[model samples]
Target: MPDTLASNPEPAETRSRASELMALHRAEKLLTVVNVWDVISARVVADVPGTAALATASHSIASSYGYDDGEQIPVDLMLEAVSRIVRATGLPVTADLEAGYGDPGETVRRAIGLGVVGCNLEDQLKPLPEAVRAVEQVVKVAEEEGVDFVLNARTDAFARGRERDPEVNLADAIERGRAFLDAGAPVVFVPGKLTDEQVQALVDAFGPQRLTLIAIPGTPPLARLEELGVARVSFGPLSQNVALTALQELVEGVQRGEGVPSSMRVLN
Candidate 1:
């Protein structure tokens, strides 16, 4: 049977949400995303006053379901969790689709079907031509689906090249990021524990509001990023780690016979 999803018209609201997400990346202020894992986290973050959109962390979602990161969770299972989150709120969602579940175009088609208007598609250090072709495929799929999908194409040069010289990693990231942009990716995601000079170099290469980053321990401050014209900053799985840390502390306290803290708000 032919797929009805591919033939049907996309919802107007989904198109609008996609546009909104794209604008957030181009805004002067850095778009900060505290990545969510499930419906509860989605709702909690969506209710925040300034949260313009939500992003999913693949690592966090997989861990929540007892699966490892890197597409360890079944693609169908991941889609269901993402669908529940999409239904939980009206905010636009950009998912972390790690390596595109081994089929970049098909995975994005499924995500678009579930109301995901944007995604982070990692290169995983694939050959340069292969990675750029993946970005092109994602762009083509989004165009076919009739949505202005935000493709945050990620290059793992810095993440995977920590053992190499800093200059070597910087050049590689620039080369890959430029190719990804030329292939129609809206922004390039360069994730790692970056130094201030490294961030500036990337900004210089990609120009203002074209680079996205992950927030790690040594990353530059948000204000500094804004001054350098970064498009977005997201705390990947660390946000989930923070939440889990609190949960662990509460459980330990209760084990010592303490009651629930009086300051908790019933968000859910």
Candidate 2:
């Protein structure tokens, strides 16, 4: 048997939250996450009646701070932003630690320290073995911290290999996803503007409730994704885009001498 202490090292509350997050992924019900960049967004989503858990969009967070994605923002700054989000709500917060910010283990340790019970660590199409090892390192760190961290191991084959044959990208995603799962991640996150057929292929390969997806344009609807057995569907940076679009339209309307929309709520 596994060492109980090594398997569960978090405080009672923290462990409970982590377990809750894990259970959300394992359930038949799809976990819908509207990724947030800051505390306000976190609070807004958490206030929603059915928001099961919270997730962070690294791209949104970086862009909010006027930095680019791909780890352009400093690690400490990202952690600080995550810390605020974690503190802003009682729900579990899963971060998108893009490629682990160069130190998968250490970054996860720090994120766990900040009350993050889960995270999305993308492979960025690295060599299969190297990416799998990174997943292992993150799982090890989470185990050491005693939290059943929901490692949404992301395979970016489709995202990065758009120029290549669809079959090649699909094969790469399946291979990396299986490797990540074998290495210890609970679910595999495949992000791209994928077709319904491609989504079905992943769900079939990973099995029901074991695959996660990002909701991009042309993606299947939530009901369809749930039917396909996708455990989770997150908006990633697109949530921020929606918010920004509203803001832009509001400003443009104001320039035309129109005031704030009467339908706006004081969410902040």
For candidate 2, report its TM-score: 0.95
Write candidate 2's Cα lDDT for 185-264 as tens digits.
99999998888899899988888898999998889999999988999999999999999999999999999999999989
Highest-scoring model, lDDT: 1
For model 1, residues 1-268, the per-residue Cα lDDT tens digits are: 1111122224787898899999999888899999999888888888889999999999999999999988999999998888777777778889999889888999999999888999999998999999998999999999998999999999999989989998999999999999999999999999998888999999999989999999989789999999999999999999999999889989999999998889778884
TM-score to true structure, per model: 0.94, 0.95
| Winning candidate number (TM-score) | 2
The C-alpha local distance difference test score for the whole of candidate 2 amounts to 0.90
lDDT of 1: 0.91
Global lDDT of each model? 0.91, 0.90
What is the Å distance of residue 10 in model 1 from its true position?
5.4
Candidate 1, 163: how far from true, in Å? Answer: 1.4
